[model samples]
Target chain A: MQVAKTVKDINNWVRHTKESGRSIGLVPTMGFLHEGHLSLVEAAKAENDLVVMSIFVNPAQFGPNEDFERYPRDFERDSQLAEKAGVDMIFAPSAEEMYPRESPITMGAGTLANVLCGKSRPGHFDGVLKVVTKLFHLVQPDSAYFGQKDAQQLAIVESLVQDFNFPLRICRVDTVREQDGLAKSSRNVYLSETERAEAPKLYQALQQGAAAAREGKDPVPEMARLIQSETSGTIDYIELLSYPDLNEAPDGQAILALAVQFQKARLIDNIIFTLKEN
Target chain B: MQVAKTVKDINNWVRHTKESGRSIGLVPTMGFLHEGHLSLVEAAKAENDLVVMSIFVNPAQFGPNEDFERYPRDFERDSQLAEKAGVDMIFAPSAEEMYPRESPITMGAGTLANVLCGKSRPGHFDGVLKVVTKLFHLVQPDSAYFGQKDAQQLAIVESLVQDFNFPLRICRVDTVREQDGLAKSSRNVYLSETERAEAPKLYQALQQGAAAAREGKDPVPEMARLIQSETSGTIDYIELLSYPDLNEAPDGQAILALAVQFQKARLIDNIIFTLKEN
Candidate 1:
């Protein structure tokens, strides 16, 4: 597989692919790949003639106090996995290469970006949308793959694509998970041995919430209590809201999400379940 | 030439052209086409296999107090002008069609958008960049055209293209002017008989500034004074700054820009020139 480390290289490679009449697909990711990212790559490979996986650990998406500096990255390991997953090209740009100058223009994701994770980490999704938009422009892909693990991120990206009229389809892959039910995340590596043991409780609580909502019971309170009782971690938030919109989840299929801090790691997980129609 | 009033029609048309191995160029304008807008279409025709002209008088770019409602638009005239200038397609989406939902995401142009005309018309460049970015995405042109008459606007769009890594070229056509030197603008129709006669002085003052700068003299003060002395209109501003950046122009080259108010019409003009290296 070809590896591109600069904007010019990727643009040339993608353009050449277009000129040759092959459909291009992009799976944008930060490195330290796991099954979740690999799942996106798999989906991309399934649909397109060529798949380009971007492995840039974007610092713009991380806030000043967030773990931007400590974000894990292993290029050698990621390259091997991408090749194994049938990626045609791996575009791994350095921070300096991705952002040559201080960005003079930025996207402000309005109302949708102001809820859930956005409340805790302000400007995070805006940063994500900006980089995603840049990658979309550079790749000019026929389709782009994103993981449903980062559901809010995926939804915001879909909004950006639709609102801006980007000529591409967003294919969402289901969240990849550990056998015990912990959603696979790069930050999962940061969990202490004890924290790792407790991580599955986050997703378990989400399933419980979904089950409760399906059974005609209010899920927010029970879900919040379940996380507090089952895990030794500190609860950040346990929200039951409409999928994608994150508004109050009315009487229908909605998302129940939670973020919990376990020592050095913050783990997030969610589940979607339906209630009787209103 | 085909005229499309919906997004789907234009996207399908552009996609067909791409599939047939032809390059598409875009000339985005706010209708009421003149020689200036036609020059952009002419430039687009010169470089690409097909040219798509977008006639959207974007309300997002106008302030509540601005002339958005009164902005002159004549589709019959514009269609004839575009066809005569060799445009292949005209995408004229209505405001409702263009903005199906109030935009959830918008571009904030940061420092570059808050100066010069941006200062007087807050959120103006933001609206322009948003719509321009949308057109760029929908049209998916190989190249896009803009007139140097709106120099600041041109620079901002170029910045958007580069910063976002858009897969297209920005072809900046030189400002088209009348014999007496008034830059061609659709807003020219707003001028009264006397205002129309006096408008050329705006360009004259810019030339005077360029000449003085070339002769090793400070141009801002004299340029401001010249506009006041030569025109009966009120001088809103007469400043000299660096091209594209709009920062303080050094000894090598600079842009002289101005805004003048004549009864109902507000006219703006600028000239770019170089001096001996400092």
Candidate 2:
């Protein structure tokens, strides 16, 4: 696979690829590729003529006290994993290259972002939208792959594409999880031995919450109590909201999402499913 | 020329145009075609294989008390003029069609929007950015044309393209003016006969202000005085700032801009020129 480190280089590849009448698929990520990221690549590769994986630990998406400086990054290993996963190109741009100056245009995630992960980590999704905007412009992908693990992010991005009418399709890949039901994340490395054992409970809680919602019961309090009683981690939030829209009423589809703060890592998990009408 | 009233129609045209390997140029306008808009079309035609003119009044850009309801539109006339001006297609979508639902994503025009027009009309440039984002995605033009008559808009747009790395060029078209130096504007129709006669003084004041700046003199007070003495209209604002950035103290290029409120219309004009070092 070809590895490009600069915007000019990737743009050149994109132009050449487009001139050849090949469709491109983008899988945007923050390096230290795990099974989850590779799964997105696999999905992208299946449907597209070319698959481009952007591995940039975007500083814009990180808050001041957030783990931006310590974000896991291993380009050599990432490149190897990307190549093995059948990616056509790997775009690894420096922070300086991606953000040359303060952007005059800022994106705001409206009500959809005022809940769930967006509540505790304010302005985080706004930064995601900004960087994603930059990536979309840079890659000009025919389709982009996103995991359902970041369910809220997927929803916001879907809204962005729908509202702005971006000329691309968003492919929703199923969340890649470990045999123990723990969602695969690069931050999983930060979890202690006991915390690692506790991480799987986060997903289990989401599944139980989804089950509760399926049975026509409010899931937030039960889910919160389960996690509080079972894990050492602090509950950041536990929400059951309308899918994609994140509104209170779950009309057709809904998401049961939660965040738990361990000693070092903040683990997030969610289950998105259709709701049955009573 | 083909006239598209829906997003799907325009997208189909865009897809076909792209398949033929031809470059598209977009000239976004609020209809009521004049020589100024036609000038933008001419510029687009010279540089691109196909020119798509979007005649959207963009309700998003107008404040509640502003002239949105009274914003003049004549699509039949506009299409005819656009055809004569060598436009390939006209994408004229309705407000409802363009905005089917409230957008979850919002754009903020940073410091660049806070000074002149943005000062009086809150959230104006943000709205402009939103619609322009939609148009840019819809048309996917190789180069988009903007008249420098709306200098602040042009600057903010340029910043948008640069900051977001949009895969297009922004062609700056010189402001088209009448023989008497009045900038051609659709709003010019709102001016009373006496106000129409006095409108050219706005451009005159900008020219005088630019001349003062060229000679290293502060130009706002002098230009304000000149317009006050010569015109019966009230001066809304008169200021000189660095071009495009709109920051205080011009280093290389500067803009002397002003807005005049007439009996019914608010007229604006500016002169953007390179500043000679003192």
Candidate 3:
């Protein structure tokens, strides 16, 4: 596996792959890899001739009050994980390299971007769109992989791809989880030992909500209340919305999302269930 | 030339070309081809193996009060013109087809977009980005062409490709001017006889500004005075800023932009110059 830290190196490497007729795949992540990110890499490797994983702990996606600086990153560990997962290249760019200038153009906001994560961290997705877009340009991938762990981001990216005609396919991998059911995330490192113990409750709440909806319950509102009841961890929001369109999850299409603050570290996770037809 | 009005048709066409190892070039425009557009097609033909033109008068780029309804379009004439210019495919999607479901994810705004057309027409750049991105996605061109007549737009699209890693080279064809010196635009159809008679002065003033800059005259004030003094039509703005990153162009790397009111129609144009260093 090749590791490139500079944008030029990554661009040249990806272009070489393209010219050589290799179908490139990209898995963009704010690094500190876990099973979730590895799952995406594995999915990319299965579908693409080459897979490029970007390890960027993007600061823009975090608000001034949020933990941008404290975000965990271990390049050596991530590189090993990616290589083991069959990634062909790892692009780790400095903040300056990824965003040399402020974005002059703006992607129109995703509707759900305003609902959960967007509600708590405004301009977060704007930052996400910008960096993801820059990476898409760099990788020139035939397909890009993203984890369903970040369901809203998955939807927004799908929207970006479909709307823009990005000349690439976006493949979504299912959420990867811990043995106890906590969805894997780089931010999971922030959980204190006690908060870590309570983290599984967030996933449990999501599952209960999904189960309720699965067993003939009205998913949206009931799921919301169950999430709100399960954790007193300053609920950012718990929504049940469409997994992909993020529109009102037509009785047949919806996912349960949860965000809770545990010991000052905000942990977000969601579980998508196939709902019965309206 | 084959014409594909649907995204699926164009996507298939581009895929077929790719199967044979040919590169596709895209020139996106709202139908009503003029010399300016033809020059873009000429640049694409000269550079790429296959050329695709998208005729979409994107409504998203127009302000509420702008002329979307009256935007001049003649599909038959445009198809003939593209064929004459050696265009291999014309992708003319209807507004409904182009915008299915009001585009959930849109391309973002970059530097040039916020200033000129962006200020005059709120959400104009958003619309440009939406359609341009969609065209890029569907056409999968190796290179895309735009006229320097819309210098700021050319800059924005270039930024999008660079920022998004769209896997295409961007070529800026020089502005195509008429014998009387007006920059070619499909909106030229909006001009009545008197307006047509007055339009040439807009470009004349722009030239005067360029000449002043090239001759080492203080470009800012001279450009302002020249543009304000020479035109009978209502003027919106005229100013020259040193080109970005190439800051303080002693030899004048600059962009000259203007908007003029001719009757009820507002027309805009710009020219970017790279002065040979003294």
Candidate 4:
């Protein structure tokens, strides 16, 4: 498998692939390979002639006080796992290489960013959009793969592609999960034994919320109540809003999402479903 | 030459061209076919296998009080002129087609946009960046052409491409001028008989400023005084700043730019040059 550590290297690979009439699928990620990231790569490989997985822990996407300093990175492990997962190439650029200078063009996430994760972490989606814009230009992939685990990010990215008319497709892969129903996440490592035990209940609460919504009932309060009773972690938020758009409409496709803040980690989970007709 | 009035049509042409391993050069313009725009077309034709010209009077780029409603457009004339100029295709979509819904992503021009024309016209560069982003995505050209006549816009665009690492080159085309040295612009039609005669002085003042800067002398005041003494139009602004970055530096390459608001039209002009070593 090819490993590209600079923009020029990745672009060279992209150009050669395009010249040979091969379609590329990009799976953009921060390093520390896990089941969730591997799932995206698997999805990308199935749909494209070449699968490129970008493994940069983007500094732009983290808040000043956020976990940017401690964000896990294991390049050797990641490369081995990516190669094993059938990734054709890995783009792992350094922070200096990725951001040579401050960008004069800044992208705003608009109203879609003012809720949920956006409310707690301002400028987070903007940073995500910025990096994604650069990656899209650098890779010029035929299609980009995004996991449903970061549903808000996926929605915002989809909006960017639609609004800007980027010449690519967005493929949404389902979230990888543990057998006990906890959403698979790199942050799952930060959970204590007690916190880990309680984490599964977060997803369980979301499942209960989904069932309630399926039965034509409002699910936010019920979901919150379940988490409050079961988990030791503090509830960050629990919301049931229109899927993708994230607006206050529950009749159509909706997402029942919640975030729980533990001693060392903040974990989030959601279930997207179409509400049954009343 | 093919004339595409829809995004899908343009994408089809782009995809077909890419499949055949042909490079595309884009010359984005707001129609009324002036000599300046034709010059960009000439530049694009010389560099790429296919030249795609986009004639879009982008509403996003215009202020509410600006000349959006009255922006000059002659599609029949433009199509004929473009065909004559050897344009391979023209992508001219309607405003509704370009902006189907309010975009959830907004682009900001950053510090580069807070001076010169940006000061007088807020959000103008933001709008330019927005439309340009969409165009760049739609065309996906190998190189995009821009006239140095809109020096600020060119600088901002160059910054965008550099900072974002867009996989394209920006070919700078020299400004097309009248026999009397006035910059050729579609807005030239709005000038009255006497104002038309006085217009060439704008370029003359810029030439004087360039000459002064070449001699290591301050040029802004001198350039402003020359315009004030010579032209009947109101002096909007006259300044000398670093080329491209548009910051207050005069040592390296610099630009002496000015704007004059005539009775019915606002005309702008500039000259870019490298300062001689002291």
Candidate 5:
């Protein structure tokens, strides 16, 4: 696979691909490619004539107190994995290559970013939107792939595309998970042995919540109780938000999402499903 | 020339142009066609195989106290003018068509938008950036045109394109002028005969200030004094700022800008020039 390290190279490559009448797909990720990121790449490969995967640990998306300096990165492993997944090109730009100066224009996520992780980590989604916007412009993909593990991010990005009239389709792949039901995340590597064992409870609670909501029970509180009782960690939030909008869910559709902090890692998961009317 | 009033139609037209291996240029205007806007169209026509001019009197760029409702618009006139200027298409989307729902995301103009027009009109540049961004996405032009009459707006947009890595070049056309050296603006029509006679003083002051700066004098205060003394209008501001950044001008390059209010019209003008070292 070809590897592009500069904006000029990637744009030139994309221009050539378009001139050849071939559709291009983009999969943007923070490198440390897991099964989840590979799943997005696989989706892109299936749909497009050329698949470009970008792996940049964006500093704009992290707060001062957050793990920006230590966010996981392994370009060699990522490039190999992306190639194995049939990616045509790997765009691995350094932070300096991506941002030569401070970004004088920033995007505000509006009401959608005011809840969930947005409340916990302020200015996070603004940064997310900023970098994603840059990636979309640089890649000029016909379609872009994103995992549903970051459901809020997915929703905000979808809103951004629609609101800004971005000329690309958002292909949302299902969340990749471990055999034990815990969602696959690069941060999962930071979990201790005992925390790893307790991590699956986060997803379990979401599933149980979905089940209760399907059975006509109020799933919000039940999900919170289940996580609090089952996990040996601090419960950050247990919210039943409306799918895609993140407001309080209406009767027939809801997303049961939660965040739990272990000794070494913080894990989050969600189950979005439709409910039958009572 | 083709007229596209919906996003889908304009995008389809743009797609067909690209498919035929032709480049597209865009000139975005707020209708009420004048020689100034057509000049931008002429520039676009000269540069690209196809040119798309959009006449959207964007409400987003107007403050509540500003003249949004009274913004001049004449699509028929604009289309005829655009055709005469050799434009390939005119995309004239209605406000409802442009914004079917409330925008879920808003752009912040950062520090460059915090001065001059931005200070006098809060949330104005945000709106300008928003609609400009929407137009860029919808048209996907190879190069977009803007008149330098709105110097601050042009600078903010240039910064937006760079900071977001927008996949297009910005072509800045010189400010079009009347025979009397007054800059052509849609609002120029609002001036009474006496006010029209005095309107040229704004440009004269800018020219005088530039001449003084060329002779190694700081032009900011002198420009303010000339406008206040010569104009039969209330002087709002006369400032010299750095080109493209709007900070304090350095030794060689500076932008002399002014805003003055007539009995029936609010007017703004600027001259950006470089001085030879004394």
Candidate 6:
């Protein structure tokens, strides 16, 4: 697999690919590649003529008090994993390379970014949208992939793509999880032995809520209560938000979202499934 | 010479052209087409295989107290002129078509937009950026053409394109002028016969500023005084901003921008030139 370390190289490859009329697929990640990232690559490889996987730990997305200094990084491991997953090219740009200067223009999410992770991490979605826009421009991909683990992110990005009239199609792959129920995340490495034991509970709690909702139960309050009862850490919010929009779903057709401050690291996860009637 | 009043039809045409690998050029105008707009269309036609000229008298760009109700539009005349200018298509979306739903995304100009036209007309640049962004998405053009008559607009759009990575090449055409040296603008109609005779004074003041700067004079304060002395209306601001970034030029490569208000209408214009060793 070819490895592109700069925006110029990626654009060169993209130009050649587009001239050949091949559809390029992109999967953006923060670089501690896991089974979840692999799933996105697999999806890209299946549907596209060329698959590009980018690894950049974006600084704009992390707050000043956040764990930006020690988020995570292992380029050798990430490149190897991406190659193994049939990625055509690996774009691994440094933080400086990814963002050369301060972004003067910020993409506004409006109401879409006012809840869930947006509430806990202010200016986070703006950062996310900024980096993603840069990536999309550099790659000029026909399609881009993201995991549903970041349910709100998926929704916001989809909205950005649509609202901006971006020419690419966005695909949301299912959230890849561990053998147990916990969702895969690079930040999962931040959990301590004791906190790691409790990490699964976060996803487990989401599962309980998802199950209750899927069984046609009005589980917004129920899910909130169950998550609050099971988790001893500082809970930011444990509410059921409508799929995609993040509004309070009265009929419970919403995703169960969770965030808890375990010791020092802030952990978040969600489960999305619609309520169905017999 | 076909006129498409609907955005959908224009989209269909533009999409077909894109799918067929034809490069597109866009010239967005607030109708009342004159030599200035057609000059932009001419530039687009020279550059791309397909040109889509959109005539939209955008309401959002005008403040409530401003002349949005009478901002000057003549779609039939515009389409005829655009066709003669060799434009392949014209997108004449109504206010309803351009903003069917209320726009959630709004743009801000930070410090640059806080002076001159933006200072007198609040939210003007924001509306300009927002509608321009929407036009960029819908047209998906390889290049966009804008006249340098609106020097601040040209500069801000350059920054916007760079920040958003919109894959657009902004081609700035030279300012087109009437026989009297007055810069061509749709709002030039709002001037009375006396005000119209004095319209050339705006350009004359700019010429004076450019000449003085070229002769090693600090043109900022002098140009402001010149513009104010020449116009008999309420002078809003007569400031000099640098090219590209629109900041104050340290070495006299400044743009002379002015805004003057009569009884019913407020008018704005600008000119840019470089300083030299005398």
| TM-score of chain A by itself in each prediction | 0.96, 0.98, 0.92, 0.98, 0.96, 0.92
* Candidate 5 structure quality by residue, lDDT tens digits, B57-98: 898889888899988777777778888889888899999989
Residue pairs in collision within model 6 = none
| Candidate 6: residue A276 lDDT (0-100) | 68
Colliding residue pairs in candidate 4: none
Residue A60 accuracy (lDDT) in model 6: 86
How do these models rank on lDDT, best leading? 2, 4, 5, 1, 6, 3
**lDDT at position B88, candidate 4:** 95
Count of clashing residue pairs in every prediction: 0, 0, 13, 0, 0, 0
Candidate order (TM-score): 2, 4, 5, 1, 6, 3
Which pairs clash (backbone N, Cα, C closer than 3 Å) in model 5? none
* Candidate scoring better on DockQ of 4 and 6: 4
* Model 1 spans > 4 angstroms off: A249-251, B249-251
Where is model 6 more than 4 Å wrong at Cα?
A211-232, A249-252, A275-278, B1-8, B215-230
- B1-278 in candidate 2: lDDT tens per residue? 89999999999999889888999999999999999999999999999999999999999999999999989988788888999999999999999989999987899998988887889889999999999999999999999999999999999999999999999999999999999999999999998888888889888888877888888888888888878898888888887889889998787888888888988899988989988898
In candidate 2, how many Å is residue B55 off?
A: 0.3
Query: How well is each residue in A1-278 modelled by candidate 5, as lDDT tens digits?
Result: 99999999988998898899999999999989899998898899899999999899999889998899888888888888888889999888888988999867789898988777888989899999999999999999999999998989999999999989999999999999999998999999999887788788788778888888788777778767776787678888877777787887556667777888877677888887887777
User: Highest lDDT, which number?
Assistant: 2
Q: Rank the candidates by DockQ, best first.
A: 4, 2, 5, 1, 3, 6
Docking quality category of candidate 1 according to DockQ thresholds: high
Please give the DockQ score of every candidate, comma-separated: 0.84, 0.88, 0.58, 0.88, 0.85, 0.50
Lowest lDDT sum, 10 consecutive residues, model 4 chain A, at A218-227
**Residue A45: error of model 2 in Å?**
0.9
What's the lDDT for residue B147 in model 4?
95
Q: How many angstroms is residue B167 displaced in model 4 relative to the true structure, after the best TM-score fit?
A: 1.2
Q: Report fnat, model 3.
A: 0.75
